[model samples]
Target: MSARVTLYSRPGCHLCDEARAVIERVCTEVGTTYDEIDIDRDPELTERFGEEIPVTFVDGRQHDYWRVDEIRLRAALGG
Candidate 1:
């Protein structure tokens, strides 16, 4: 099964990098994995998340943008 958490990001984005770290730490603690999609790879994605490169989705619903909230993520996962 795919991971419940999805991160939309692009290369060389400092905020994206920070979001990844938070997602990684939270997901690991919750015993779950996450999917990272590079927006730069898809024009549609790039347009959709142009300003919000570090967007995060939980359970197929948009959760956060530009940053990943560790406490909220852990709570969402019921960890």
Candidate 2:
């Protein structure tokens, strides 16, 4: 089964940028497909994850926040 990862982020968020970079690298290494969501574009997402702009989801479940835990993410992807 393929893994689907999603990154929730917003503009001007350094942590979010860092997390996205990490996710991009990991996705490339693991050959997984990922998408990034700008929470600011959606009111519900903004409200749900405003304080935590860099939330990550793996296979539709909340995975991490603030930063991308590479070890944990690798495990999640079965890498």
Candidate 3:
């Protein structure tokens, strides 16, 4: 089974970078698949998450923002 994760982010954002590292590691360890969407690519997404570029969603539900918790992510993905 694939665990789907969505990341709302933008270019040149340090926080987003950190979040990516955490998500990437956890996702890889758990065999979870993730989509990284640049909020700037979508007007609606930009308007909604512009201020929180590093937002992460697990199964379509918001999980964290600005920073990612590796342990929490692993638990969420049932890793």
Candidate 4:
């Protein structure tokens, strides 16, 4: 389930920060990597993810919203 991890985020988002921390920690532990996209920078992304920031995508599919579950992320990444 875990391939490319993408964090759809925005500036000044506390939840996004938390989610990013979890993603960074997990991905580092698992030797995986992720990309952080500021929704504010992209119109389409901002529109799609406007309401729910801190959205996560695994392998280009939506995984979690608003938060990152470390255990679930670890399992999904096959760690």
Candidate 5:
């Protein structure tokens, strides 16, 4: 199966932005598809991940929260 990645973020969040950029660059290099989710737009997601805006998931599993670790991400994606 193809790898799936998702980023949970909100506007004006510096860490979120950084996480997105990291995901974009790594996903591009690793040939993976990713989607960004704005937690503010969803009540359940907002409640579950409000404090940790920039949470990331790979294949529907929580990969990281608050920050992006490139090495962990690469390993998760089998890079």
Candidate 6:
């Protein structure tokens, strides 16, 4: 399957940094990969998630924003 996780973020976002750490750890433990999209690079994404960076999508659906919950992420990924 393609990567089931997607993180929408921009550079220098502290929450995005934190989310990345959590996603990396959880995805690694679950043997799954993820995609990271820089919202700043896309006008649509920037408009959609400008105020809510660090957004996460699991299985093509919105999962979380601003912060990442490790347990919830693990559960979502069926880790």
lDDT of 3 at 20: 90
**Which scores higher on TM-score, 1 or 4?**
1
Tens-place lDDT digits, model 4, residues 1-79: 3448999998899999999999999999999889998989889988887879899998788999988999998888889
Candidate 5 achieves a global lDDT of 0.91
Which candidate wins on lDDT?
A: 6
User: After superposing candidate 2, which stretches have Cα over 4 Å from the reference?
Assistant: 1-3
Give lDDT tens digits, candidate 1, residues 1-79. 8999999998899999999999999999989999999999999999998997799999999999987888999999999
Pairs of residues clashing in candidate 2: none
Q: Could you give candidate 2's per-residue lDDT for residues 1-79 as a string of tens digits? A: 6549999999999999899888888899999889888998999999999797699999999999998999899899888
Q: Choose 1 or 2, whichever is better by lDDT.
A: 1
Measured with C-alpha atoms, the lDDT of residue 4 in candidate 6 is 91
Worst 10 residues of 2 by lDDT: 1-10
Sort all candidates by TM-score, best to worst. Answer: 6, 1, 5, 2, 4, 3
Stronger candidate by lDDT (2 vs 5): 5
What does each candidate score in C-alpha RMSD?
A: 0.6, 1.7, 1.5, 2.4, 1.5, 0.7
RMSD of 3: 1.5
Give candidate 3 regions above 4 Å deviation: 1-3
Ranking by lDDT: 6, 1, 5, 2, 4, 3
Global lDDT scores for all candidate models:
0.93, 0.90, 0.89, 0.89, 0.91, 0.96
Q: Show how many residue pairs clash in every candidate, following the order shown.
A: 0, 0, 0, 0, 0, 0
What TM-score would each prediction reach against the true structure? 0.96, 0.93, 0.92, 0.92, 0.93, 0.97
